[model samples]
Every structure is written in structure tokens, then in C-alpha cells.
Target: MKQFIVELINDRFMIAAVLLFGLGFMNLLLQKNLIKKIIGFNVMDSSIFLFLASQGYINGRIAPIITNGVFDAEVYINPIPSGLVLTGIVVSVSVTAFFLALTVRLYGIYKTVDFDEIMLLINKEAE
Candidate 1:
């Protein structure tokens, strides 16, 4: 019964992740605002990260990070996904910062956040 419950939970989590990924991709493709696009990108990243972390978990397993010198491979969860999330967090931060900076510059030049409005403004200004 316990194992069945665990499998059911895992299946639900995977399904949710797949749905999130689909929505995130759709948002990324559909949104015109840079902020919305960045949010979608972050959501997509989170879905994958969650999936990785879930895979690292095991029943009755201790965390992978050892306190002393004891290396219990059989009971410990995988640390790779944690490390991966850390690196991804840093990368995502940098990307968001760069995107925001670009957005600010775009606004400065055109004084509009709307993509269509900015393009039209720039064209008119150019004429």
C-alpha cells in the first residue's frame, strides 16, 4: 500500500510538471512583454528542477550531504540535482538582470513597454 501510494504521488508530480512545462512554453511564445517572457522562462526552469529533486528522493534515505566522513550511498539521496539547481539559480539571476537592463534601455529609447507601440514610435521618430 505504501509503495502504491508513493508511485501514485510520483505520477501526479510528473503530470503536473509536464503541464507546467507546456504552459510555460506557451507563455514564452505568446507573451510580448519582456517581464512576462522572463517569468515564463523561470517557470519552465522550475518545473525541470522540481523533477530532478523529486528523483533524488528515496524512502528512508538520508540526505546526501554528509556531516562527518560517513558515506552511506545506499540511504543517501543524490546531490547532483541540488548542485544543478544552485548553478541554474545563478544563471537565471544573471539572465533576468540582463533582460531587465535591456528592457530599461528599450523603454528609455522609446518610452513605451508595448512591443508594437515601441516599434511604431521608433519608425515615426526615424521619419
Candidate 2:
């Protein structure tokens, strides 16, 4: 048990990523406001990026850039995760912007950003 605790402490970034993911998932499920939901989505995206970055990093390895002509694979950390995190960030930002724009349009039409309120308004309009 003590060893497990130490290992967990050493892998703090992974633990933090998992905790952040859970928090974001809970927020996404429990929130009623459109803006809050979008924020939760962003949190989830960030957690995923953090997890990827942490997974790609090594204690003694350098970035995958060539230095002093050291053409050894073992000396450089994997670059895939860094690339993936960068791509994910771009996509996350675009998605977040789209969601916010949609929320704004909904607010303009219904005068409320709450999901329940919007449903109630729609139901009233239908009747």
C-alpha cells in the first residue's frame, strides 16, 4: 500500500488528469446552463490534452528535436502526443467557439440559456 501511494504521488499528472476528467464529466451532466455545459466540455478537452502530454513525457529524455547530431531514438521523447495535443487544442477551440455561438443564438431567440427553460418555452410555443 505504501509503495502504491508513492507511485501515485510520482504519477501526479495522470491522477490530476483523471480527476479533472471526472469533474468535467460531472459538470457536463449536471449543469443546466448552456454556457456552463460548454465550459465543462472545454475542461474535458483540457484534461485529455494533459493526459496525452503527461504520457508522452519521460524523466530524462529531451524533445524530439535533433541536438548535436545525436541521431538516437532513445534520447528523445515521443513527439506524437505533442502533435496530438496541439491538434486537439485547435479542434477544441473551434468546437468551443461554435458551441458558444450557438448558445448565444439560442439566448437571443428564447431570452434564456438554461436548457430546462428553453424546453419549457418550446413546449409553450408548441401549445
Candidate 3:
């Protein structure tokens, strides 16, 4: 148990990622408001990026940039994971913006962003 605790403490980024993902997932699943759901989605997205960035990080290494013709693998951390995380962040932002736009349109038409209320209105319209 002590070893586990020490390991967990050392891997702070993993713990943070898990917490963010869990919180976001709960919010997404349990909330009725569209805005809240969007926020949850953002939280989960950030957690994923955090996890990826953490995977790329090393204790005492710089970025994988060749400086002055000195090329040693040990001096530089792998850059791919960080690059992927950056791409994921950009995509997540765009997706969040799109979702918010849709939510705005829904609110304009229904005057509310509650998920159940929107479903009820749609069902009533259908019948």
C-alpha cells in the first residue's frame, strides 16, 4: 500500500487525468443542460491531452531538436506524443465551438437548453 501510494504520488499527471476524465464523464452523463454537457466534453478532452503530454515528458530531457549537429537519443524526449496532443487540443476546441453553436441554435428555437425539455418538445412536435 505504501509503494502504491508513492507511485501514485510520483505520477501526478496520471492522477489528474483520471480525475478530470471521471468528473467530466459524470457531468456529461448526469447533466440535463447542454452548456454543462459541453463543458464536460471540454474537460474530458483536456484530460486526454494531459495524458498524452505526460506520456511524452521525461525527467530531465529537452525536446527532440538536433542542436549543432549533436544527435543523441537520450538527450531529447520523443516529440510525436506532444505533437499529437497539440493537434488533439486544436480539434477539441473546434469541436467544442461547433457544439456550442448548435446549442445556441437549439436554445433560440426552444428557448431552453435542457436536454429533457428539448426531447419533450421534439416528441410533441412529432405527434
Top TM-score model:
2
Runs with alpha carbons beyond 4 Å of true place in candidate 1: 1-8, 68-70, 122-127
Each prediction's number of clashing residue pairs: 0, 0, 0
Query: CA lDDT of 68 in candidate 1?
Result: 78
Predicted structure 2: lDDT: 0.95
Instruction: Report lDDT (Cα) of residue 83, candidate 2.
Output: 98
Between candidates 2 and 3, the lDDT winner: 2
Candidate 1: worst-modelled 10 consecutive residues by lDDT? 50-59
Candidate 2: which stretches are off by over 4 Å? none
lDDT, residue 52, model 1? 70
Candidate 3 residue lDDT tens string, 1-127: 9999999898999889999999999999999999999999999999999999899999899988887686888888979998899899899989999999999999999999999999999999999
lDDT score, candidate 2, position 7: 100
lDDT of 2 by residue, 29-86 (tens): 9999989998999999999999999999988999999969999899999899999999
Error of 2 at 18 (Å): 0.9
Winning model by lDDT: 2
As a TM-score, model 3 comes out at 0.91
